[model samples]
Target: MAGSQGPLVLGPMLRYIGETDATVWVETAEPGVVTVKADGREWRAPTFSVMGHHYALVVVDGLAPGDELPYAVRFGDVVVWPLADSRFPPPRIRTIDRSRPTRLLFGSCRTSVPHDREGNSSNGVDALRALALALADGEEAWPDVVAFLGDQVYADATSEAMRDFIAERRDITQPPGEEIKDYEEYAHLYGLAWSDEAIRWLLSTLPSCMIFDDHDIRDDWNTSWTWQEEINQTSWWHERLMGGLSAYWVYQHLGNLPPAELARDEVYAQVLAAGSGDGAEGSGIDLTEPVFDLSRRVDRHPEVYRWSYRRELGDCRLVVVDSRAARVLDPDRRSMLDPDEMAWLDEQLTGDVEHLFIGTSLPFLLPPGLHDFEAIDEVLAQGAHGRLVAAAAERARQTIDLEHWAAFNEGFAEVFDMVIDVARGNRGRAPSTVLFLSGDVHNSYVAEVTDAAARHGAQSRIVQAVCSPIRNPMPRVVRVLMSAFARSLVRPMHFIAARSRRVPDPAFPWLVTDGPWFDNCLAEATIQGPDVAIVWRGGEVRDGDDLHPVLTTVGAVRIPGGLDDGARAGESAADGRPTVAR
Candidate 1:
């Protein structure tokens, strides 16, 4: 607890039940009476403490879908919304029309750094920021939902505001002091992360869904057995992990899920089911006790719970996977997802939606060059050349821990098969496009998975569209080097892996036929008539104060027949695209 402040944040906004009835969750700068009003109605929810942070989950339920409603928050009769540096206006209620398909603007990985002083000098337009600006300027169309894929904040990379808050509460001069290593520090980190002006307003107005990535806890989270081994040995690791997971429930996770799911969620069910009477507003079921126990239980028995969640819009279903925390870290058998999680994903993919969107924080497909490098590393890990293999394996384990899908071969293969099965029409009616929407690589690009045997009427093309580092950008040199290396070595690396017995060949051989280029971009995909059109728009810095955001059209692909076409017609269009033949 630092000095008491007044402005409360009503955000991490989620629109459910057609955007008319939105669920707004908030944290008070100070414990006080928090009330919300939407559609001329007011609801009061009690705020409670968790390691010094006070939070309230208010469901602004009951409103007309497809209509915009204005809402505001009050703390003890005084308006305390949009704390300071207000970059945007108050939230306007909006609704979704299920009869027609919707445009979903999604991306992840944002750091809480101050925007450039001139504002125009900001190197790249943040995806979220750009959306806000667009809405403010009355852009033509708005995305129905903004899926914030992952890493909304970096717990390890504490900002100055977070550092100041921590220092004020406890003497960091002591060993292991300044850095956040416990529940208390995590509480403050959440405050700084979500308390931004533009993002808060955007979240409040637009419907949002979210998942977590490594920086949400720590960098290179759950890449391999060796990486886990190293992290577990650190003295502060347990507290850090526990704090991160616990705070995640209170701050982020609880709001993203629907009311029905929350009621069924084991831990959250307890929170919702608990009630305390006796004229005490802040007094309710103690969130800390169950939260701590649940975090520990999930950590010890990772299989007992699941962080993955799914949402369906019209005929489309979006499955978001939790790559970290729910990992099987055995050296002999490793996977990003446990068996239970994989099974859930398998079931979700068995459908014929107009569009099937699989959202993962990590990209399912990496650059061809990077993919080859990983295969080479895996071969060495399997005893390629005595100690050289062993040493190379160790370094590879650490370096690769932070990125790529190759590290989690088993789980990756499971998803691969599931996706391939859907594309091949093993499922009911294959979707127009099995679109994989992802972010984590810090750069954005689009890759399509075409079936080689599809020309013979076997299967359709599956596309992967990535929008990453919504706010973060890699250095120019690093970007150039990565592209150069991927282009030069991808083929040779794939050859070595395919020839070696250590790494099994994938069911569908994927090639980066379009691009391995880097750009701060946002991808937009919409189903128009029978065809699904996808376009990648890269952001360009403007020359003057009022420069329009430039969106470079990188690529677009169309899936011929829409969702209604049965397996017979699906086979023809599915195999119509040319395979990336080596």
Candidate 2:
């Protein structure tokens, strides 16, 4: 809020960066003309409202690939960014240049903790802040884009700041008081998440894409039908669901679409039609009712609106999946994604690119043992066991968050086939590698399919990379449980469960090659030609300035491109196994 002389509150943050165009999304203090000026050009978009909150998505046109555009926003001559005479550099937007190497920074599960002694001591260093400072060292080899895989902010897990705001607004003694209650509270939550100076500058400059996981609304969101039924009976659930989805559309999802898609957005078109100034020449009309209605419908029937988005960044393609929202929750046919969403994903899940990056907030590839555990849990919960055992299985499943791809056997089979088919070159000129970029379990690791014959069948290398909790580290007890799960004999149990349920074995046998790093971390990917490389880094305060966390290597992996046929037949995952740090 330093640049408070103007109406802008949270952004001028760049989004949806493409070859010829870019989007700058902002939250304003009032509804009025919101403009983005850059490279001696501008695109004016009027501020639109949802339940009294104001926002604008300004689309800037006429740029070439690899264009370095430094943009600023204004509301009626009031400059809202860079503050007058500020020493900080102007926020920049670097469009994707396909000819150049593609680098993406991804991580998830962040809490807005204060960058001080207490927060660091409790939750470890804020890795995203460390990444910003790391990039500040030089322009050399900076990421072209950053994909926030999931849980960019914890709506369910409130920070002290968010708690304070809630305490001020409502009685803390009331039920569900600490969690976000409405769209207004969600707005405040976002402000808290984005206000840190270093992170703010980083967001304003970096072309960021986001997908939400459980904590974005609540932990274990959409985990199961039973859990959903229990939560729906709560008094505040309706308001919370409505606010989270509505605020998400304005703050996160709207910017995910391209200009052509944005043009097709009916609500957005309404705002565009609104005049660009005060009262918009009598066209300044409130759009609260329509916006709220849309939010409600999307929350109740997520299948109606597609939140999943894809970006073709040069030779690398990034597909961000809406795993949490688009669920087919029938007891008999449970799926993480409904049929339509799965079909849409199938279309995007292809070859032809040097690297195919699948961005599911929840890792599509879990540890083999955990994968089986979930599968077994699903089977038992579905009454493969006795009725009493089935009820117990359901309770345990909700408690441990065993609601991943393996739990939805049908959906898992679909994606497994899709990945295998794409890798086998059935879809197109197979990508040199197919990498699943994900975060959600609050740990970082690398896993790859190890089925030798499957590798022989695949023309492209397939791997899973995960980075989680950029700020919110898992508790010690949970870490112990995760480690135990990683080392369990659930594989044999899973084999039995799959047999009992008549579920086929996975198309590819997989193993976790690198790590299960529990530190707050961020991961980066670099794709050059047929070779793709990934590294996970965490932040540690090992110096005099305890505030600025130092970046430390967690683990790294390298997958060579052009695995066409049996080039890497003997090797399981990449070169031997993934290189481990610790």
Candidate 3:
């Protein structure tokens, strides 16, 4: 039965759709059986509570491949979904078709705000909303999956609505201020981030996968050892970290796993096995303490829980790495991934698929100039120039956000060697392209190792494509700086790198192939047989219609299905600008 409170709270988000089974995750108003009906079949799951918030992850099984069936969600006996006035079509579940090409949408760092004119003017139009509108109108074809790389919610950067909610419960003058503090606050923040009708409808129908970045907890989260020690001393860090991790498990991470892995999850099983409370609307097995304890334990030992995951979609392998967590923060030997995580990733990075997509929140291959800078900074901060210089370098590292794959040179080289192995057909049959798909720099770009199949003798096209800020745009000055680095700093950086004893010469020299575009946009990468193509799109409000912005392509590039043909396959547009490849 639907309760006095609304039947649905946040979602009926479609997550991890496979050939036979799919998951629909929802936050309900109460502890009720959430049902999903499609193609004359119904599947139901019981709601589990976390800090009084109820949720269900209904596994709809036994679907035929490539089946597109309209679905509805019911709360007990009441039909509670499709709202009654939804402007979009009824949500449908489309199972994966292995024989067909794979299309994926990816981006990161969206801030929750109103979709009004003012919000659009301030933060640019919401690219996700634009995509949703376009999809509803049948303008854009549906993607197989939407991989949200990181920063799904900015916990530190509160919007007006979030601030109001915070002020209602706590003293805004206190430590952490408007920033979220606990699981309850995180619940509300997620509601704000996903409750927009257009984006909500989009999420309900499209299969989405997500990971967390720094902004999901705070800016510069897990940047370095010093950062960890400083943040640990804060009066509120424990609650914030526990709440963020717990809420993440409930909201984002749980749905990331396939049905089998989800079933095997120990914490999920514990919640399900706990005692149900007295059949009340909001009463059930509350997992507040259990999840909090799980979060705390993982904080103490990150190896206990791996946030990194892998998906085998058709002829493509999508490996989403947990770049923020599982870091070796030791100053003497800093690495992006700890030893255990690295071992796991090593096993997953082998190539046999048509295309291999590594979805890391941090870019694995930065622009060469920027990459050299970060590598040099890492050594300087590690006492390459004595204690006082090292201290200054450490301060600069945090101040300028110099944390990326380049900062962890050892980890970078280890992965680079593995990629080289894969590209050289040492691991398996070489992929047509090895793409590092990333999104955290608040800009979009495509970079490639420019060498002939003759010169490098590699089979795959090694590439890095980044898309970010599905809503939040970077400042104008920062954009200019990034553009300058791409344009003029490569030779100068090479000279600087030659002088540094700690920095190793790269096996393959690379350069930016397409963009440094700072538009708040989403990138679509489609792998068809042996070729891959990428297009970056943003929202454009036209004729004062802020409510329904048009989805416009900002830039596009196509990687032909073949070996490296010298500079032929990697050439840019004739006019030296990003073009929409028709």
Candidate 4:
């Protein structure tokens, strides 16, 4: 590797990886020639500027599948990797081998704080940092890929350090000053989130993907048409929405695309056309105006833009949905996914695989009791009773996030039927395990759904595995409130709520078999030939020179296939066994 590159401002983060192609993203103090060298090949790309921020994505191609390669990042004559790499067995990444089963690591809601005494005491421990420490200590096995479910950063909940930076630059006395105001602020937020030594190394060597939740933009963003109407009236919301979505594109979403898809990106092509003369110092046609407009257009008309994507891993298919931006918030016809988005999801739901993983930031299947409560709230909020009742319900709904899948009954039914068809082998050959990997609601738990309909040969085990609050826990009061709410949904209340819609019973009934663990945690999903097992683990800081994060198992469950249509859930252990559905 060359000499130390002028201190990397952000990442050597490994992004998308195909059988023969890979993408690496980075940010530096000032833009310069960025290069990646590995497997006896070299790839060079120049950084582009957006509102004075410099970024580069170097795509390496022509690599064989399962190729084990040591890669280095160089900015001009400075080596930005190798020395900064992790001191573990597999320091470099090995490309994906399509023949192997998919092992995915996932979680959400992480706060970026220092890994020292003061930081830990203030914000608790960051599970992401903990995972990084586990990797540093050789205490965890590397997975094939990582998925950040959502809320990767909280624009509404700024830390003291973030506030301090905001105060230093602009007037803290002004409106919308405490929270993030624009793309520049978002860049700083991402820098704080990704700059830690251990996590940086882990990200540099792992293939990763991400989606944004409410907090990533602002609390209760796009929750309802009413909420949208209110927010749009605010003076600062327009700029804030543009900033949040645009920053997401540049930071998280852009890297998720493969080489062909990235080339097809209209904005990327536009930027390239305007940036032909730039020599990595960001001396080209400015991109601020066009990029910002593009972002705004995406929010204004999400149907014109496509943010959802699907990828096939070995015999398993991974579908990551954009549950936020692509929403239809009509009061009479609210849906988490618009019709176009639903069509896209319908196309992706077909199965001829052993395992199918659906990644949504919000859990599709919450506890049956909790799901009933949200559905009831939505009905009341939609004027099922009266205007006054509707008004009160709306307040409660927004206050407590009664805007998940169950709240959007139409959308929920669509999703349920899609999964049911795939499970029943209506699309293609039925998959063995239909797993929904999600993280939201600030706790970890898993539930399993048993289809009541007749099965086609092999019945799929539908399950929802939730891991949340990688660093952010619900405040004690909120936790108590949620618990009380979950417990108070007795049989009579839930029955009344479910009957209010006069709809037929669900295709499957599910149960929470594992936990609602409220600790900073990460989760792993292991898929065998026809079985899928998931485990949630919390992070405990161990005493040492470095704040070492020790992983502790919170809960684990295995959902197996090969069950007959008449088969029932088996009595088994909480770790990796089947449990009866509610």
Candidate 5:
């Protein structure tokens, strides 16, 4: 068995499993009897794989509601602890608070460069790392949970460490060498990606939930069916997907769901109900086997299984949409979520909670200019822009390089309807805030949603808060152009599209009333009391031993409960929206 080396990485962490007893899972480097001790009880999940990515799920049941308890894990004779750089103070515990409204820290598009401590010139601090540091330093209070929106790892955008690891494991001179192309390589990539100190500690200490974006597989994946077809024809496409999806299952997906849910899952049930918990003759399960067989079937027929995950925290319910794999690729009927998945999303959006947080890797609402550009290009895809422009647009789509909800109108409409219905109180009490947290565009901003109050009058309510690139920053030129384009052109196009399509566009011609810029940043929102406030803070940039994780205020927007009524009556308060000073 391989001995543990480096810092014990305890993350993609999660906190506050809500009123229900929590179930924890981890993949160990060496399997020597792993046990999770919490709530004064210990549960053991025997090791099943020799590769050291041991999957163990411990169910911490029968706990009192709204109680915070410290917990720890043990591996054989050695005690496996959360990293020293943990964000929240170390006793590695869970707080089960139901009365306090949940505070969720969410953002995505983070890259894992070597931490500065290793003498490796790194990209600034990880946004999650900064948040962790803040929590540890008491600069910021701990959130009830952290939801990692997407792109946790870029299989296509591999790092030096990832490339080197792949080189040692397999002969790269072979057809798909030097980069990850299959299940075996993907498994190795995950191991390299998560082996970090700050992140490990963060994951171990916080209860994090995650979903996948394009980079999680490849950039701009599933923009259209044409893109899917083009990628499928590539020499290394099959292996790449197999590795990507398989690793996702082991590293991310399994941990997001409750043990009971997993047990009920057909695939996981086979693994659990297996007699010896090993790949025995009559055991009926083997997790180490290539996930290609399973992933391929799902890709071919997305309706067969759904990878989306959901959880309820007190009065708030979070629905994480699986935008990539579950897409409907048919030419005539294209959408982000297929019918079944959409129905599942609709069901989850019903009136059981005070707030609904929909986590999609791509923002449902993008900069208006970008949205229009995509809409125009999509029209070109259908042969509207003569031949040359149409061909060029189609090429871009085939290469997987488009963004915006219009690319998948079917799915966009479904989500839009969900938002509208929820806002209109069709789904229980309209959440105090129907907030969307997203990351793919690489720049972060927040926008509020408004509907025509009097059969065509602008009345706003829905809000979108975006945080991106926990490390990766966009090029200066691209950023300038995007900012200008969004400010000038995009806003008008949204209104035009709404009118031309005869769809009820609830969006107002909004500006970046907050920010259109920021370096790698993490976003946090608190739903405590009757008020909701969302804030974004940039990450720290270090030079030598001088760590500068400055918390620059990007923008803070507050949604007051009575403001909607005031706005409707034309009784405008400060800044026109009913917001109290933060």
Candidate 6:
């Protein structure tokens, strides 16, 4: 058994790549020492057990900056990765280069389904797959890192494959039937989501970071106090919450940390100390109790664990905030972030960097009309109208997903103030751009804060860049409704919002300058010195090939640095649509 190399169950994913070190995460079929050999150097880490799943994060250090080298994964004496029949080239790890500008690929809300004609027709092409194929074929420039904003897997809205797995395990008619109920189910769900060969290879080569959104736990996960009360009543909510968080720790959150921070993590330390013994069955440590206990503590008191992290790439700072679990749900003091998380975010929003990227799963700036509508819903739900109206408002809020930053008025205002201050050089030397990178509305757009408002004609360019649905496409009717809200209804909504005594005037007015494009797409943001350029791309099938789709540019825009009002807000076009400011 010790000599036998077990099949890799999930990953050989490259995560947390830094200037001179990188970590590789993997899941093995059995408890074993995972080895990574790159550039004539080898590093090994023993697998730790999470429930019955065996995994390891091998930290490779002492490499020089800008070193790009092919790597291989090994279990015992046998090679388990870069499979003999694989079509892609050997996966390589590229260390950070301080001189080069930062290029980041980002998007959210992907559903795992067949990549055939039927799935493509229903969900549009898989933009991520297209990116991977392009990179594998040496057709596009490689991003330094990829940030998946949210919904890496939909625990609430299961696909047919997930539902079938659920049916196999439990009664389909029962409560939480199709929804994932425990760690095992979540593990299976992740397997389905990441097992695609092309994507697997992409993950193996590309450094990636992720944060969870509503669907990772459930839809409208912590939308309000009422939402919590309702969900807490369900028989399976405890197990589901515990399971979801534990799995998130094992799968997504673990990779977000660099070696130093990861070493300081209490849960990781405990797991490492506990140790999974050998590749033999029944020899591994069972982490269910400790892991679930940690999850329960987190769910009960979100302040106990923070999911947010900040990374400095060259002169750019990328702060990925956990807008979900760390929420303050008291209706009287509703906030997207709790006090501690907000304070942490405050520290991260400084302007010393040339570009500051604030990544939240939910968009910080919504379309103007939708922002007003959501704000109105929040106010009404808090009894701005009356008790009867408030009750109805709460129901409507959950039903239609009016739970973005706008719904948490206080938090939204505070963060907006922070951005304004940073843009105005109050925090540090004002960065050239203070940008919010987000997803989760099933559409994509670029919104710039109106210069005449609270922008105060600041030196920095403040913009919201949104991309969503790396695969899942919104229905046509919903697309039409979104377009109308994004463009046509802005004036009316603003007028209505101005009349609401309970809703304070927005810190600034903004407009969607580029898109409300409802494509299954991804967005790439490149920061060169002080200037920032954004491009959205989607996959398009050619020659009746369902699996091999080519990436087509959907939109492109640039935010000029050291802005003068007359300085051109750059423009670009794709699919015969204007995608930037005039």
Can you write out model 6's per-residue Cα lDDT over 1-582, one digit (the tens) per residue? 111234688889999988899999988888867889987878888777888888888888898888899999987678898888899989999988988878999999999887999989978899999899999999999899999999999998888888888888799798888889999899999988888888999999999999999999999999899989998998999989999999999999999999899878977766556544322222255666777888999998999989999887878889999999999999889899999999999999998889989999999989888999999999999998899999999999999999999999899999998898888888989888888999999999988776522236566778899999898999889999889878888888878988878876687666787888988998999986777888889999999999999989998887766555444333221122333221
Better structure of 3 and 5 per TM-score:
3
Listed in order, each prediction's TM-score against the native is 0.87, 0.94, 0.95, 0.93, 0.87, 0.94
Q: Please list the residue runs of candidate 6 whose C-alpha ends up more than 4 Å from where it truly belongs after superposition.
A: 1-6, 274-283, 452-457, 564-582
Instruction: Give model 2's TM-score versus the native structure.
Output: 0.94
Give the alpha carbon lDDT tens digit for every residue of 1-582 in model 4.
011146567888898877788888888667677888897777877777788877788778888888778888888888877564446434465677877767888999988767787777766777777777777776787678889999888898888778888888899788697999988888888888887767778888888988889999998888888899999998889888899988998889888888788778877765455444432433233557767888878877898778788766767888999999888899888889999999999999987888889999999988677787788888888887899999998999889888888888888888988988887788888888788999988988877664333333336777788999888877878766555444444354567765765432455666666677787788988877787778777777667533876778877777666456566544322344565444
Which is the better candidate, 2 or 3, if ranked by TM-score?
3
Tens-digit lDDT track of model 1 for 356-457: 888888888776666656656755664666777767786766664433677667777888878877866789776766778888887776565434334323
Scored by lDDT, model 3 comes in at 0.85
* Error of model 4, residue 252, in angstroms: 0.3
lDDT by residue (1-582, candidate 3, tens digit) is: 111227788888999888888999999887878889999988877788888888888888899899999999998889878889778899999988987789989999899989999999899999989999999999998899999999999999999999998999999999899999988899999998998888889999999999999999888899999999999999999999999999999999999999788768878776445524322233266777888888999899999999999887878889999999798898888899999999999999887788989999999978778888888888888988899988988898898899999999888888888887888788899998889999999889988766636556778878899998899999998988787667677778778988877777777767787788999999998886777888999999999999989899998988765475454533442123432110
Count of backbone collisions in candidate 1: 1
Local distance difference test, each candidate: 0.66, 0.80, 0.85, 0.78, 0.65, 0.85
Sliding window of 10 residues with minimal summed lDDT for model 4: 276-285
Off by over 4 Å in 3: 1-5, 271-283, 564-582
lDDT of 6 at 134: 94
The 10-residue segment with the lowest total lDDT in model 1: 563-572
lDDT of 3 at 260: 88
Model 5, residue 561: displacement in angstroms?
3.7
- The alpha-carbon lDDT assigned to residue 524 of candidate 1 equals 69
List the pairs of residues colliding in candidate 3.
Answer: none
Residue ranges of candidate 4 with Cα displaced over 4 Å: 1-7, 84-91, 271-285, 451-458, 480-490, 502-507, 544-546, 569-582
